[model samples]
Target chain A: MRRRLKSAVVAVPVAFVLASGCQKAAPPPPLASVVVASCAAIPAAPGDPAWDAVPEYVAVLIAQDLVEPRLLRLSTPEIRVRAVSDGSRMAFRLAWTDDTRDDLPGPAEFVDACAVQMPRVIEATVPAPQMGETGRPVDIVFWNAAWQATVDGRGDSIRDIHPYAAVDHYPFEAASLQPGSAPQQEMATRYAPARAVGNTMAGPRQSPVQDLSAEGPGTLSPVPDGHSTGAGRRTEAGWSVVIVRDLPQALTSQGDSQVAFAVWEGGHEEVGARKMRTAWIPLKLEVKP
Target chain B: MALAYNWQIGRSMSYWYPENRPKRQFAAVFDINKCIACQTCTLACKTTWTSGKGQEYMLWNNVESKPFGCYPLAWDLNLLQQLGAQQWRGKEYAGRTIFEAAEAGERVLGWRPADLDYAYPNVGEDDCTGRVDRGAALRAPHLNWFFYLARICNHCTYPACLASCPRGSIYKRPEDGIVLVDQSRCRGYRECVKACPYKKVFYNALTGTSEKCIACFPKIEQGLQPQCFVNCIGKIRLAGWLSPPERARADNPLDYLVHIRKVALPLLPQLGLEPNVYYIPPVHAPDEFLSQLFGPGVPAAICTYRKGPDDPDLAGLLGLFGSTDRVVPRWRREDDWVAALDEDGSQIVRVPLKEPVYIREAFDAQHQVTRTNCP
Candidate 1:
């Protein structure tokens, strides 16, 4: 059934437009569709050869200045998106330009990040792009540069962040308690309360991408037992990140979906709702016969 | 947005949420005139909480000398400059609050301090205003003056930090009104750190979460004062429950001092957070600066505070400060003894209204030696 839908998607015509004008040119018309090409296996990295075969959709980014705590300035002007699916899973490769690499979290510092948002349930009408409206929920896969750094061998320990920090001792590291013992784990949890409480943002990172679901603004929450996987690399001029998640079952039958993108430039102090974002873009899933 | 009544501003101001007051509000009164800047409270808080890896720079309780001193350097001056011309019409504030002054698409008018800002927690420590001339004589209201402003989380009635958090991770405890950040829910956004005018909310880099003075809720739950309050060397702090002005009781120490006696005032009341921590304005500081810091209540509060022995009720209530480690919900002055009481009207502690003075003879005839330091 999935293979049948793959061939059906290829039959759909691709609409591509090029703008040519004087010094002052009209803004390019919004990209008609983001084509999700089918492949034997979804790429796990942006540099993978399979992504090269996929069409790139350049989405214009606008500052999120529509609500309270909004971004007043635009930082990431545009993002290039490429996506592919391998029968059971879907992956997106996002690349954007950022001058500085901000991966360290500090008192006032924010980390560079990007997110791919899709409606939790596909319906006749697309959900609102602003994190979806009430009742209409969206699933978001958020990747952070700092988390990527942690996963890429940079230590998540305090000593790694503050090399000169001196400490007499931590009760959790006491000699009496055996390493990895229940008592030691309990003591460790006492000090790292956020980690003990299962805050995904705290503690060590297994993957850079976090799965979240939101009903509307201020409702973003981590999805339990999320299986998303991603990797991000810092290129000379910017960052390229690949995020993978299980393919939505509805796409196999409908062959159509919608996705939105948001980017945060840590150097520009962008985080939370203060980010550059795009409205919902049409997504077509290609099937292979 | 909802209109919440801020007693400090003496008006209903713009707030993100409706006025949902707690069952009981945690409050404290700091007698600024008595603070000697010993930093015992600072150390006490440090030793109790915030002693972890990423909390090296965190000071849940800090003492900064006013006029020239600031933790996170100029946490107040920066916001004050932005708020612009804080005006007062008697007890009513005529100026825009941080909420009202919020820019387009912003929750509160606030600024986040840079990482280096926390580097100089003791910047301008002990620095005084106006140079003392060569022949400057001792006088009431001295020319050069500075006071130690010991600060903790205000646990505000309308916390700007709580209002600005997009995740709703920060909340005011409906039981005691202690504002806190839910560690599990926080995504290290630091929106609270940027929105708090007092800069009490701190971002812990390692944990990737914001931490603040829990108001020592552990102790509060046990019916004891916070570590800072119990360890204060100056005996200038009194922790208690505060009732709203309309429901204020004369016997309630916080209400008596803040509402009835009006001897203690909230810091930067014009910002409109309705900060719970109250200060007895420094009696010697100039009115201009004091008024700006404590709102229009400065002169009156200082006046009432200076009426020292004459105002027995106020004097006795002050004597109750640091009299016990237990939280004082009710108090009374009977004859020469002032007593601190619990919620059920049982005495927690008591102290004499006046310290018994003793006069020692210069000649120690009994010991056959002269007492050099005695009068």
Candidate 2:
């Protein structure tokens, strides 16, 4: 009798599961869409009171495992996104939870970062979300925490990082050469080769955000004369950042488009292709009467 | 992926790009038996290239006592452990290379050293293998042994740093086969720093980019040896160009020692980077340990090195090391002397195979004084 009772107990759930399996599985819930609220002016800071009026769109992030040097683990699970546009400019606010704030790049350390990607040209069929497919380009606005710290008056000198470091002197600082002279500049360039070559990443930053374009994975390049502005603030929960860029041409006439997002946690040793990312989500512009 | 011939492994192996050899490869040979661990070469390289603000800890050239010493502590031990069993059959390596043993997503099997790993660059300096007893006396082939190993970027035929760079910023120069990181293009990803099996590539936090030994290309272009090679107090290093085995010319000093006599061997050939720098195995170290560190060529190399005195040609070639600051592309042994030749076959420098010796007369009649230290 006990055996029969046990069999009956197991058979009931099994039959129900089998009956449910026989029918077609329900489709997954649709991803959350973002609506860009029209504003008179775009706010440059994440903590601005003007951002409170915009609705939040929660984006679920997955591991970026599509290419070589992949992020097999997801450090950040999701992020809260908000967007605002004022005819000529667009600004996005992204907030996420993280316990450790990493902004310094040491020998073995990486910085926390985030980027927003959008298709350069809106077509009938959207480009592949893996940094966009070949022939179809994507515009990316990247913000780095270390760059933010630099913009906020944090020094990048070796002595600034290593307080106890002692050096006799750099050749560029020699008294023989006049300050800001051609010879002094040449000597300074010898020490900092990247800056001498005009590598934008190695130069002093005027803004924390960078404008980049990509055709596929590992093809990220800086867009010449790109003007983007951004600011980030640390809250009790984690990081909140605001990235401002030129409004896309498609959003003006199409009223609807797609956007993607990526986040990196410095404490997790994430950099380059190792990050948590989200696929394209529907974006709509609220039409004004 | 394409298969490239690695003579060290004695077989074609998988590489990221196809086989594209340079016009001529930069190569060097370090004679280990003569090294005195003076660290002069280290200082020479440091003061010349790595003295900048961001490169304080970077040693483009370093001399570490082997069996315990390593720059990024345990660099070889960690890679060997992860690579598992490395076997060999005669001259061919019967093992998987770093590229072959890579995981699904990675291009090479490697580990990134922590920041602290570089803190103690000379941790096990002068430490011997076996313990010395209370009354242990030194004898021939003494059990407790240690050798100083001087290292720099190998400028490998197939550089792991070049293969693993996602930005394609690190490149091997086609003219001289010297690998370098393009400063402007690097994004500080540090993939090269992590992928180099020898742990030679270093990351600069101040510049936010990776740097490594450029083999002193400016000097090389002028036909002068690198600072480290020229400044070696022990006269243990020789810089020259090396050709592939099929095209190796016996008149070339590097080819004569490496291909003809086989007196020097590449370090850890089983890892299969086909490193350009070769080391003549120490005579006193055990064969098993030496073979593991070098390759199956250790026994034959040691044998040939031991017979160096009897072989005048070999002896003359070794005497040419550290004889000049110029790069010797070709050489010839004429009678009692060896001549280093330039690329145009003109003699640059020459050294006698044996130093001229003189014994002072026990009694100098003219001075009327006796010599107390007569030989």
Candidate 3:
């Protein structure tokens, strides 16, 4: 009887071990790659479109500065990063070129003519993905070092201000044009009168040039008080505008004269003029008589 | 041991300009007449200096037409309108300028990101009417008149970019007077971009450094012209060195600059960025218009009186004024106009100007007309 009992204990322990072993372990899940979309598709970088919504977000840290975005040309072996869209997540790789911004000494500041690169990462988010689904891709971004910190208010120091503030802010009185006029007429009425009063030059037309280059030796004639006294001088070089006239609507449409008074008067020398002064406006005009 | 290595790196790092130091002296003289509207200067600059990821739009050097164009979207107009016209002198930029900023409390780095975006939009592109349609079809006359305006960093005697750099990343090279942004030291704050009235400084997203035109000193040192000057189809560009003191000279450079404007010659000087790029009045425009464009001094300067039926000055006019801006640099109105390197009181040393070999055409054009008469 004692021998039989010991054998039964051993058999019972063995059976318990076997039973536990028969239970199956969960199958290992599949590995997946992360994908990201472009900013156009998602407006924000992947992982969290609103991830940067918080002020503490790294992007906000960079974007807050009030500086114009510029390119940093570097000439070293760089990794090229092309931006690709995968919804909000975009994909990119670092690109390298031979350009560098390092300055070399000489009469002029010489810069190397090769492209450079910066490092960035790609991250994405999956709203309704199963446990191990592949997420969207993120677009590639590059680093620019020219960013300066932003200031909350207009700087107190004089140096931090623009020099031409006054002219830029010069007040403009909107012309209350006559009701239902043609687009051209409405524009002329709104701008022409104010311009005429501002230039302080006599005549219905504004001369294109101040001094007339004479084609022949003629005695200088004083213009009558209300009348402008110059004609188109045919210099061997070219024709110079001697008198400026603001022609009536009738003459301007005919295109008989070089001075298009009504048309020129339509635009004000306000903000547009300031922009004109700073930026390059490429305009080529030739008069065929 | 690590500290020692760091110290060694720091010691090796030296710079040409430092804060609170005396500013260096440098100047550039653009030959207004030589420029052609090919935009080779802009391309040369973009390819050589500003081509990078962030600087997709940045143009350290740009050519703009007068009377109707500007970069950074009318930078001067914004400020001018803010401050009504009033009495002012040099450096007395009243009211709000692009560089002006206010501190928010005691924050050491008054960092405000949103304000930066609006203050200076670099390389601000706008639609331009480059070629005006005076008429259309065979009967319609089209005037091909686009002015070439080559631009670069002004490196002002008193650089606004330097003054406004809160971290002091921007500096002017004392040796050659080139203003540069130190990318390594720069935290990408972009203060220089905001502060520069000319908006020459740009934020390069790739390097996070503000990039600008480097004056091509390497090529200059090698005794070669900058890419723009060398590649210019129209010999409109001249590269040379101008002494710094010229800015302080009692005879303002404008006297010479405006010389072209005074005789029905227009300079488009109202923006107040004090651009180094100047224009020699276009030949085809009328004198009264030119006078308006340039102001009132051209007629007197050119001796434009008619001598009977045969105009004497006509020949001189034709010779002096061509269909383009390729005028002799010396004849330009800058106070520092130097006839040659050896000339006394010359501000800038003249370098070799590689005139394009339109030798036959130029000679024929010059000879065809009387030396002083418009043919």
Off by over 4 Å in 3: A1-289, B1-25, B31-34, B87-146, B222-224, B244-375
Residue pairs with colliding backbones in model 1 are A6-A287, A6-A288, A7-A287
Which candidate comes out best when scored by DockQ?
1
lDDT of 1 by residue, B148-216 (tens): 999999999999999999989999999999999999999888889989999999998888899999999
Q: Chain B of model 3: TM-score?
A: 0.55
TM-score of each: 0.91, 0.90, 0.37
lDDT of 1 by residue, A1-289 (tens): 9999987776553321122222366655655788789888878987888787788899999999887789998789999999888878999999999999999888888899999999989888977898887899999999999889888888866678767766787767778989999988787777776877889888767899999999888889999899999999999879999999988988877888899999999999998999999999988887633
Candidate 1 Cα lDDT to native:
0.89
Global Cα lDDT for candidate 2: 0.88
TM-score of chain B of 2: 0.94
Model 2 segments beyond 4 Å from truth? A1-31, A166-169, A174-182, B129-131, B134-142, B358-375
Worst 10 residues of 1 chain B by lDDT: B134-143
Candidate 2 TM-score, C-alpha based: 0.90
lDDT of model 2 at residue B346? 98
